[model samples]
Target: MLRYSLMRLGIFAGCFLALWGLVYVGALPRGLGDSNLLWVLLLSLVISAPLSFVLLRKQRDSMSVEIVEKVDRAKGRLQDNRTREDAV
Candidate 1:
């Protein structure tokens, strides 16, 4: 899960930097005042979301399966502990 999150963050950073460069080079328009940074962040999310969904599908699926397995194991342990307490 951490790996997947880091990968998404990396993608967003790459998008933001690329967009920032475009603005610097006069390729893209910059927003007024502090809205410039806000625009970059929002645009980065819009650009990165689809890219991450497509590129990180396998990693995301594996992370989810690992989480489910962990939850199942925790539940099994809890059930066993409850049974032991009841018998005592």
Candidate 2:
């Protein structure tokens, strides 16, 4: 789970840095280099989301399986405790 999340963050960071670099190089509008920080961040997120969705599909599936297994185990434990209490 941690690995998947960190990887997603790394992707976003990479995109953000790349965007910032483009802005720095005058490829994007000149004023947004430092003046429009929020726009830059929002654009980065928009770009990163689709990339992460495609790139991290396997990681996300693995994390989902791990989470589901943990939930099932916890539910089973809860049922066992309930049975013990009812018997008492």
Candidate 3:
């Protein structure tokens, strides 16, 4: 999970930097007046979301499986405690 999170953040940062560079180079139009930074940030997030979804599919699936396993273990523990209480 931590690995997947860091990878997603890395993708977002990469997109942000690349977009900023493009704006700096005047290749992409800047947002009106004071909104250029906001524009770049929002656009990078939009671009990075789809990229992370596609690129991190395997990691995401593994994370989901890990979560489900943990939940199952917790439920088992709870049921065991309940059974012990009933037998007391």
Candidate that would win on TM-score: 3
Give candidate 2 misplaced runs (Cα > 4 Å): 31-34
Candidate rank order under lDDT: 3, 1, 2
Compared with the true structure, all predictions reach lDDT values of 0.93, 0.89, 0.99
lDDT of 3 by residue, 1-88 (tens): 8999999999999999999999999999999999999999999999999999999999999999999999999999999999999999
* Candidate 1 structure quality by residue, lDDT tens digits, 1-86: 88899999999999999999998888988988879888888998999999999999999999999999999999999999999999
lDDT of 3 at 68: 100
Alpha carbon lDDT at 65, candidate 2: 97
Model 2: per-residue Cα lDDT over 1-88, one tens digit each: 8999899999999998998888778787645455667766887899999999999999999999999999999999999999999999
Cα RMSD for candidates in order: 1.1, 1.7, 0.6
lDDT over C-alpha atoms for residue 79 of model 2: 100
The alpha-carbon lDDT assigned to residue 87 of candidate 2 equals: 100
Query: How many residue pairs clash in model 2?
Result: 0
